[model samples]
Each structure stands twice: as C-alpha cells, then as structure tokens.
Target: MLPYWRLSGFYFCYFALLGGVAPFLSLYFHHLGFSAARIGELVAIPMLMRCFAPVLWGWLGDRSGQRLLIVRLGALLTALTFTGILWRQDYLWLALIMALHSFFWHAVLPQFETITFGHLGEQSARYSRIRLWGSVGFIVTVVVLGLLLDRFSPAIYPQAMLSIMLAIFCCSLLVPPAPVAATRSALPGDGFLRQLWRPGVLVFFFSAGLMQLSHGPYYTFLTLHLEALGYDRVLIGAMWALGVVAEIILFMVMSVILARFSLKQLLIGSFILAALRWLLLGFWADSLVLLALAQVMHAATFGCFHVVAVHFVQRSFAERYQGQGQALYATLSGCGGALGALYSGYSWNALGAGWTFALASVAATLAALLLLRWMPGRAS
Candidate 1:
C-alpha cells in the first residue's frame, strides 16, 4: 500500500504539470500574440518530439535495466529544460524549448508505467484505483489555475507551470524502485520491428493515430475558442476539470469495466464517443450544458481507451519488451496528437471552427470503422 501510494504521488505531480499545459497553454499562446497556426505548431512540436524520445529512452532503460534511474533523469531534465521558456518569448525559441522539454518529459512515463505495473504484480486489475490520483490532480490543478488566471494575467502561466514541473521532479526522488520481473528474459526473439510490422499492430497504430490526429484541433484551440466565445478562464478551466472528473470516476470503476469488456469493444466505444464529442463541441460551443456533457465523454474516449490499450500492450509484449511496447504506444499517440494539432491549427484558420470540428468527427468515425475492421474480436 505504501508503494502504491508513492507511485500515485508521482503520477499526481506529473499530471498536475499536464493539467497546467493542456488546458491553459493555448490561452497563454494567445496572449503571446501567436496566431492559431503558430500556437498549433508550438503545441504540436512537443508532441512530435514525444514520438521518438520515449522509444529511445525506453530502449536504453531496457538495455541498462535501470528503469527508475531513467525515470528520475527524465523528470529532472524535463523540469530544468522547461525553465528555458522563462528566458524567451519568441516563437522559435519557445518551440525549441518545448521540443527539448518534451523529449525528456515524454521518456519519463513509459518507463514509469512499466514500473507501476511491476509494482501491481498480479493485482494489475487494481491499476485504476492507483491511477485515479492522476485524474484528481489534473482536476485540482485545472480548477485552481483557472481561478488564478481569471484573477491575474497570462504572463504568470509559465511560472505556475514551472513550479509544477519542479514539484514533479521532487516527487521523482521519493519513488521507490520496483524489483525487475524475472520473466524479462523469457521474451521471444520475434524482433521489435517485426512485431511492430504485424498487420494487426500496424492497423491499430494507424487507427489510433487518426483518433489522436483528430484531437489536435481541440487541444491547440479549445481554450482560445472558448475565450472567443466570451467564456471566462474560470469557466474554461471548469470545463476541463469537469472532463477529468468524469475520467476519475471512470478510472475508479475501470477494473470492473475491463473484466466485462474486450479491449476492442472499449476502443470502438471510445471512437464512437469521440465522434459524438467533437460534433457536440463543433455545433454547441455556446451551450455550457452541452459542452460540459461533451467533456464528460472523456471518460470513455480517453480513460477507458487508455486503460484497455495499456493492458493490451502488457498482454501482447513480453516483460523484457514492456518498456518498448509502452514506448510504441506513446509514439503513435504523441506523434498522432502532434500531427492532429498542427493540421487543426491550419484548418482552424482556413476552414473555421465548424468545419475543423467536422473534420475531426470524420477522423473519429474513420478510426471506428478501422477498429471494427481490423481489431481482433478477442483481446490480444
């Protein structure tokens, strides 16, 4: 229980940093006078870095058998490098800083996940109970920061974010290392690339990538969109928190859901929810109730999808390749997210909000179709 608490604490701080960045950063970029396209580029660059960074770091962690050290180094370096943002406001400099920070920050999680599951052992079904702390942290941060931004200026955003990162780094110091699983050596010689190239894996990556790509517009422009619609920062923050709160509830019950549903079923359900969610946002941005309800779907769209996907990776890959398997998940999700954000930026400028969101709806639908066609009937 102490170990679980410690692991949960690490996630709490880690996601607190995310809470600041994901929900508020667009508003910050807006205040910085960045065009929508520029803001998208800024947001997407870090995600693009995530596509490759985790894979490299995961590989190294596996080779050295020092997952904890990798996690510590990644967190510390991420915090230190992000401080560079304070020294530069220029888009190019900030973009470079974001890329550097994301390169390190992205590596921290896949290895940490490997460690967390290791700690859970055969009781892995209880992962959601421990992981729910992250959702709680995200909700708390978004609500608090929303109030802060409403009362103050956007200039303080980076400082607030830096403080969270520093806290995350400090928390990394407290996380006890887990024992290496003995089954690490029993992994087959199927080769990483070969496994990655399998038809089902390839289809899964492409479909998941499309799903994330569709979210690019939402992540890069949601706050800005709300602001343009006359919503206050606090309200926007509430919307973000509302979604995560739903996610927390889902996490609390995830073990039961997983027991009843196949991973494919969860994945397909999430895509369908995502389609409806974007459509709601596209057409009903002015309706607080509708928007809030849409946010709640995040429970299905992200939380359930993530849990099932992580479990699938755990079941499919051997213990030795666990880090790499997680890394691959990060790569597709991150890179796809980056691409989605960037493209959304351009489309938002050119196509307008309604059409941009409509496109996202299309992407989500396509992902659902692909999942129906490609995902195996049974959990892999």
Candidate 2:
C-alpha cells in the first residue's frame, strides 16, 4: 500500500503553513510597520535561500539514501528557526531568521515530492490527487485565519503558524522511507548532467521559472491589494480560498485530463491563461465578479502547470537523480520567485498595482511563447 494518508497528511500541514504565509504574511509585516520595500526584502529572503538550499539537501538525501531522516531534521530545524520571530522584531533579526529557517524549509518539499512519486510508482498520474490535500490545507487555513484575523488581530499569525510547523514535524515522522525500486531509465550519474544540458530541457526550466516569476505580485501583494480596494479581510480570504477551490476541482480530475492531453499542451494552456489572469487582475480588479472569474484560472495557472512540470522533471532524469531533478526545479523556480517579489515590491510602490500586474502579464506571455516554440509536442 502507498501510505496515502501519511503522504497527504504531510502535504496538508506543509501547505497550511503556506496558506498562513501567502495571504497573511504581508499583512503581518504591515502591522509591524515596515515599509513596502522592507517587506519585499523580508519576503524575498526565504526564496533567495531556496536558490541554493534544496540542491544541498537533495544531494545529501540521494547520497545517503536517507530521505526521511533529512525530511525530519529539516522540519524540526524549520520549526525551531521560525520561533526566532518571537525572539526579536528587528529587521536584521528577522532577516537572519528568515534565511536560516527557509534554508531548511525549502529543503523539505522537493525531497518529499520525490518520495511521494516513489510511492506512487506506476501511478505517477495520481500525483495531483495527493497534492490536492495541500490545496485543501491552504483553503481551510486561509478561510479560518481570514475570519480570525478579521475578528481578532494579525498578531496571532505567528502563533498559528508555529502550531502548523509542529504538525508538519509530526507528520514527517509518520511517512516511512520510499523503497528504492528500479526506475524507468537507469542512467549513470554522469548522464544526469548531460541530460540537463539538453536544449529542450534548458528551455523548459527557463519557462517554468518565468511562470513562477509572474506570480511575484500575486503571491506577495494580492491580499494587501484587495484590502486597499475596500474588500474586507474575510472576503479577501474567501477570494484566496476560491482559487484553491478551483485548484482542488482540477486535481480531482487531473488523471483524466492528463490522460487525454500532452504535457506540452497543458503547459501552453497554463501560460496563456496566466497571461489573461494577470491582465484581469490589473484592469478589472475593481469588479468583484470579474475578480472571482479570474481566480478560477488558478486551475490552469498553478494546478495544471505544476502537474505537468513535475512529470516533466521525472521524465527528464533517471530514478537515481530524481532528488536532484526535483531540487533543481525548486531552485530555479525559487530564484524567479525571489526576483519577482523584489521587483514587484518596488514596482507596487513606484508604478502602482495596474502597471505591476501588466508587467506580470508580459512575463507570462513570454513564457507561453517559449513553451509553444520549445517544448516537445510528443508525450514523454
């Protein structure tokens, strides 16, 4: 058996923390009275660390064949490091803390992704089903916390986040190490580097990075933007939840969707939808109905795009290097996200929301063009 619950439980708690951060972290930083640029820098710290942390941990996991141990240690360290937020409120103090905790926290997901796919074995298409639990966690946490923050205060954010981190540590203990069964391709260690150098593979990574880069404004500022537009925190939370609800619905039928479509097709569709989605947010955000419709495009922008990306990484590398493959994906995406957050912060203040999102739309449009031209049309 696949220990489905164990895998799902870990994702749930892991993304519950994400749910807390994505919508509320900026609000928390705002409450701390930091400038927009400072908040941007603070948010970018973790992503900047992700540019290097995952590969280091992935190398260790692959070499030792001890993925579960690395996961536990990473989780525990992440929780411990985050508690430093309560220790001091200075920018330098939080900066150091963000970099430290993110180094470990970023290490967890890529390895866990490798392990989950290992568990799924021949049923790799089922990945979306397991991943949906994370979306579920995001929805529940965003909604509940949205309500709470509205009723109580944003100061409670840290305490709620701490509890979720502990839950993640506990879940890490429940998932046993994945069996090292034979992979579809048995490439030698040197072959992975060679495969990574392929032109098609390089283009795919670049496109994926662009996709995440386009999300910089959305992830970092959507909540604040909505609030500024006169939406209540509760409605903002519901809007966030609505996107995940769309993501969940997509995951439930992803196996069917992928069965009938190529990864190239899905990636192209995702990028195009992302372009339109950002444009909607930029030009029509004042309309609640239009905003809600735009949120539904999360099904393609994130949910489908990610499903295709994971499978692409799996196909491009041999089983022995799966950890490294996933790590590289996360690392590249992180770099893009860091740049996006930094630039968006500066732009959000200098250019305003309208122009910032227009910039994001351009990024997504460029990614779509890359996918259309470079991604192989054949199923892998």
Candidate 3:
C-alpha cells in the first residue's frame, strides 16, 4: 500500500527547511557581515554541488535499485555535515559546509521523485496534490520563522535548519521501499542515450536551464533587496510566503489547467510570466501593489513549471532511465542556478539590483523564445 502521508511528510520537512532558507539565508549571511558578493559566492557553492551530485547518486540508485537507502544516507550526511556551520562562520569554512552538505542534499530529491512516481504508477496526475503539501510547508515555515526572526537574531538560523534537517531524516524512516517491480530497470535494448537526443529533449532542458538562471537575482537577493527597500523581516517573510501560497493554490487546480493547456503551452507561459516577474522586481518593486502582483506570478513560474517538468521527464524517458532523466534535469538546473549565482554575485553590486534583475528578465525571455522557435505547436 502507498504511504501517502509518509511521502507528503518527507516533502513537508524538506521544503519547510527550504521555506526558512530560500527567503532568508542570504539575509543570514548578510547579518554575519558578509558582503553581497560574498553571500552570492557562498550560496553558489551548494548549487555547484547540485550540478554533479545528483547524477552520481542517480547512477548508483538506478544500478543498485536501493534508492531508498540513498535517500536515507543523503539525509543523514546532509544534517551531519551542516553541523560544521555551528563551529565556524568564516567564508572559507561556510563555503566548505555548503559544499559538503549540498553534495548530499542534492542527492535526496531526484531519487525520492523517482520513488514517488513509481508508487503513483499511471495515476501521475495526482502528483501536484502531493506536491502542494510542500508549498504549504514552505508557507508555514516562512511565516513562523519570519515572526521569530523579527524578535530574535538571524544567528539562530542554523539551529532552526538543524532541527528541520533532523525532521527530514525522521520522515525518511517512515516510508517503506518502493515495490520491487517499480525500481527494477526496464532499459530498452535500444539504449537510453538515443531516446535523449530524439527531437526537442535537448531544447527543453536548455530552456529550463535559462528559466532557472532567470531566478539568480530573485532567489539570491530578494530578501536583502526588499529589506534595503524598507521592508521589515516579517513583511519580507510574508512576501515570500505569498508566493508559495499562490503556488499551493495552483497545485490544487493543476489538473484542470493541464487539461486545458498542454505542458509545452504551460512551459512557455511560465517563462513569459517569469520574465515579467523579474522586470517588475527590477523596476517597480518599491510599489507594494506591483510587488504583490509579481509575487503571485510564482504560480506559473515555479508551481506550474515544476509540475510540467516532472511530468515531462517521466514521459520523456523509459522506466530504466528514469533516475538518470531526473538527475539530468537536476544537473541542468543546478548548472543554471550556479551560473546565475556567480553572475548575480558579481553584478548585484557593480550593476545594481535593477540591472541585475533586468538581466534575469532577459534570460527568461530568451528561454521563452527558444521554445517558440523549436517547439511551437509540438507537445511537451
């Protein structure tokens, strides 16, 4: 039997930790007296790990058929390695911690995603229903942590993340291994690499990478940017929460949306909206009304794009290649994210926030055009 709540519980803790980190981790580094450029480089370290770690782990998972064990091991090492942060706050040390922990952290999601789809079998449409819980968890943590940070020091951020990391490890213990039939490799004798190069796959991945690259400024600096613009911690947190709340609402109704629009249609729309969202942040973020409206665009940019990407990867690859397919997606996203981080780190101070984000908008718009050029009228 599928342990529905158990799977949901893992996502909850996983993203609840993200909820706290995504909106505020840069702020935490800022509080530690790291410059904007330093923060960007430090944050990019984990993303660099994400670029390669998932593929290595994914290969092991596919070969051994013990993906659950990998999940558990990744969870344990992630938490254990993160404890190094409590011992030192220096840049080199912090960079090492991010790299070590993220090497394992990046290992968890792809394997678990393969496991979740295996359990769902053909009823894959229900994925968003389970994934929305991740959005809820994001909202809960951001709001509650925001309130806490208003009164407390950002220095406590590591402690809070440590607690959540332990919870993720605990959640991993509850779920049984996926059924044997699901994990067994069913590699077609024709070979997986051939399937990968078949029309549109490479283009989809490249476009997806550009979209994540567009997020460089937003993810790396939004909280600090908003704080500099006179928003308080609690309000800043609410802003982040608002985006995920919108994401939750989208996940709730995704099936209807998917029925009406093909995944390629949704992906194109997501890129367009993301471009608009970055431009709004760059030029109009001081206007609370405009900012709020832009935040709501997270539904299309993240919520819809994510659901479609996962579904697309599942459909794109054969069962035996599933783990590697997901790993490739993660790899490209990590590469994009790492590049975004490095670029934003250098540009945020030199070019200023407005121009930095304007560049992000350009990346997203180009991604939208790539799809239109190569994939117009074709199904994702």
Best model number under lDDT = 2
| Positional deviation of residue 215's Cα in model 1 after best superposition, in angstroms | 1.3
TM-score of 2: 0.93
Clashing pairs in 3: none
Candidate 1 wrong stretches, greater than 4 Å: 26-40, 87-92, 150-153, 182-184, 197-199, 224-234, 285-288
* TM-score for each of the candidates: 0.90, 0.93, 0.91
- Residue 311, model 3, lDDT: 88
**Candidate 2, 196-301: lDDT as tens digits:** 8765688888988898899999987898788888899768867877888999999999999999988888888899999999989987888999999999999999
Off by over 4 Å in 3: 30-38, 88-90, 180-187, 227-234, 376-380
How would the candidate models be sorted by lDDT, starting from the highest?
Answer: 2, 3, 1
Per-residue lDDT over 92-150 for candidate 1, one digit per residue giving the tens place of the 0 to 100 score? 89988999999999989899888888877777788888888988888788878988998
lDDT for 175 in candidate 1 is 84
Model 3 lDDT, residue 39, Cα: 89
lDDT by residue for model 3 (89-157), tens: 999999999999999999899988888888887667888988898888887888788778779989889
lDDT of 3 at 164: 90
Show the lowest summed lDDT stretch of 10 residues, model 3.
182-191
